[model samples]
Target: MRARLMIRYILGEMIPTFFMGVIVFILILLTFQALRLTDYILIHGVKVISVVEMMGFLSTSFLPILFPMSLLFAVVLTYGRLSADAEIVAFRSIGLGMPSIIAPALILSILIGILSLQTSFHIAPWGNRQFELLVTKLGSEKPATIVKEATFSEGFFDRVVYANKVNSKTGALEHVFVYDESTPDNPVTVIAREGRIIQEKTDLGNAASLRLSDGSIHRTSQGRHTKIDFSTYDVSLLDPAEQQFRSKTPPSLTIEELKARMKTKGLKKDERLSLEI
Candidate 1:
């Protein structure tokens, strides 16, 4: 009965500390991402709700790393406190050995280890993939969200966008310039008096269209230059989300998928070693 009580007491002390440690570690980790998240909200014009959802998904990926560290912190701090308070001596006097005193912590560690394994192998990968998909969707659906006033923005695939003035509320641009290098053989420079970003849905997916009024397209090919003037022109942007989805990394793969990839023939030595690790 005393052993059971001691075990319960030790667990009671450790569990709360474990949660506190996890919270502290999470906050520390989030501090690193806070700047990037702020840019997502302020510069990329992402919704607050979407940012919160991103944080939730990111937290899941942090769990596997946080769990073991928190458990260890809890065990160390709880034992230190118990030792300082003479609880260890008292338990020893009652015929409890060192193993009995440490058994609760060991059992908790085992349970936490099981949970860590589940998160590391399954949950974290799913969370990482979801986070990546969300980012890609955001970039694809509204490429102009990344365009900043008085700065050259290269988030658009194979193009650089610049605007002297931008209307945040309506995404209207003044004195816009774009350099399109999607066709390496024929580079084009577009200068527009006024423009706005338009999101269009096609059979392919969401596409960004830059609607320019009173603009001229300067194209150069084989040392020849040509200028085309238009009252209104629409420039369609290529969505990179499909390409991003195709390049899945190891962290985004489950253990079974990783194993399968490792077995695939003709993998480079480094790639196979990475998967094995």
Candidate 2:
């Protein structure tokens, strides 16, 4: 009798969380699948492994999307079902009012809110960081995740570099090919035995620059073509670092961080709420 009542109470409290967790988890998994493929559509493209890594990155990226949704769903389903089933009416007939039936639900909500706060502040942030690390490591490894296989792997900013074989180690790009598409009538194409991409912090932000050694370029000007050999050459291109940081997508912050930010935004005048038990 007493034990059964306790079980019913606990069930009433958990109904919302169960529904919310199932729905939220499925939706989040789907979103991660979609975000991971973003790189595949980009010009140079991304590798599948890298894209998978990005999915790992995105799970935390969706913090602002998931937690609240779960909480909201839970509250609505639990309360709506209770009302529809006339459980509230029965409780009220037993000398309990709306407030009494709602008391347990409210307590459950408070517990979820605290859990959500912790997730927002800590768990979400940690996931975001891991996601970033995965993206960074992947991008660095396969700088050109995809490039039509034989096409010139022109990085961002139209700066092109190519390789028959990427040594991968030592950042050396082999069987190198490069084309200056920005050139007006006379596009310069270069081929190198070995090359390297150097990343430097520029005035704008982080960008990739090229450092080619043992390279030769065929120059065409007004239909006249000349081939030149070079021991070394260096050119700067766009690195996503500055712009990429914005896209890296970090996780939700902790409660303390939120408090600090909200303070700047403006605090509420009404700092308290009334509750009935």
For residues 1-277, what per-residue lDDT tens digits would candidate 2 score against the true structure?
A: 4334633684666665755674677566767567436645463256667666666556565654566676667667777877798876776676665555555656666776786776666777667767655544445434544323345654434446556766443456666778886655678888877777765555654555668789788988887999999999876554555444442222334556545544554333332111000
Candidate 1 collision pairs? none
Model 1: per-residue Cα lDDT over 94-174, one tens digit each: 999999999999999999999999999999999998887777677766676777889998846557999999886677999
Tell me the whole-model lDDT of each prediction, alpha carbons only: 0.87, 0.60
- Candidate 2 is scored at a TM of 0.51
Which stretches in model 1 have alpha-carbon errors above 4 Å?
Answer: 147-198, 202-205, 209-247, 273-277
- Clash pairs, model 2 backbone: 57-131, 121-253, 121-254, 207-239, 208-239
lDDT of 1: 0.87
| Cα error of candidate 1 at position 93, Å | 1.2
Error of 2 at 70 (Å): 1.2
